[model samples]
Target chain A: MQLSTRNQLKGTIKEIKKGPVSTEVIIDVSAPAEVVASITTGSADSMGLKVGEDVTALVKASSVMIMK
Target chain B: MQLSTRNQLKGTIKEIKKGPVSTEVIIDVSAPAEVVASITTGSADSMGLKVGEDVTALVKASSVMIMK
Candidate 1:
């Protein structure tokens, strides 16, 4: 589970929920609420996450690249 | 994206770094530094992420479940 990438941020597993096939995990970050809002609008689930659970949401490194 | 699990978090892509095969994305959340630390310990890359990139890190809903 030792990731080797460089980009690292700090957050908490604010919530955790279960679904028919998969489980959901949420992290509360320290960035702008709006930014998180936008990401959530297209990246979050529907069953509603839990209130407390430590987890990390990993995005594939290649999926995102520098714009400028 | 359009992830539909349950747990939703709020954070910013603080950094983005490139790797030999994939890119690295870093998100800054609003949770405990320690929690994020542990997760990052086993969840981040090594190529060094960017400084300002809005992204959403999605974890499989089933990967996380309710403890109680």
Candidate 2:
């Protein structure tokens, strides 16, 4: 909703992959491909998420260290 | 790290809140507080998160809808 939020990325659900243990979800962020980061919701569930759904990806940038 | 995956919640970092733009991260999960679901990492950053860090909270539990 608010892009001003530091680690929050709101987007529409592009895909949902359910695994035996975890689920992989992809979101289509508004930022360009450069600024946009692909986050993985590492879990599977029978509720809430679905294709075309709007959701927020809360990322703690610190946890997302750039490996160089 | 692999608590059956469904809505992956790996515990480590305890607190990180930096405002002005957005950054509020708190992760101390272990499935005790009744399935342990307290995820919020909106966003703020200088590098990677600190404060006894260890991060992994990727939940897509159907957007977590539970209303009565």
Candidate 3:
């Protein structure tokens, strides 16, 4: 499926921190650089995410903020 | 102030599309890489944002998504 979100970074699953309702996935997009994404536990379970898996990190433009 | 958001990309304001309630801010973070942000018009007006101004695009970990 196609996404309208502009920022899509290629990464691999570095770590997964599972919570009761949410899960935090730490991705290694670039060396020494990690991006963290918090998704619902349901989504995580549905995706069957595992460590060392290749994935894409997506952030909607509306969810982004500009710091001046 | 310090932010907990993990992704902070530096860029210049490339374009601004203003609407009644929300405004879209396009940032050129790197060559050929642009990140878009939608912020409230009130915040936009308060910030006095304009094109060519340097800014940072921030996305909270919760706002990010993982796609496999």
Candidate 3's residue-wise lDDT over A1-68, tens digit each? 54434444433344434445433344433322244555666666667656555555556656765555
Off by over 4 Å in 1: A1-68, B31-68
Model 3 chain B poorest ten-residue lDDT run: B24-33
- For candidate 2, the TM-score is 0.26
DockQ of each: 0.07, 0.02, 0.13
Q: Which candidate should be chosen as best, given TM-score against the real structure?
A: 3
Per-candidate clashes come to 29, 16, 0
TM-score of 1: 0.26
Span of ten consecutive residues with least summed lDDT in model 1 chain A: A33-42
In candidate 1, position A39 carries an lDDT of 27
lDDT per residue for candidate 2 within A1-68, as digits (tens), equals: 12221333446768878866345666676864323333344542534467676666566522331111
Per-model root-mean-square deviation over C-alphas: 15.2, 17.2, 18.9
Using lDDT, give the best candidate's number.
Answer: 3
Runs of candidate 2 with Cα error greater than 4 angstroms are A1-5, A31-68, B1-32, B35-68
Residue pairs with backbone atoms closer than 3 Å in model 3 (clashes): none
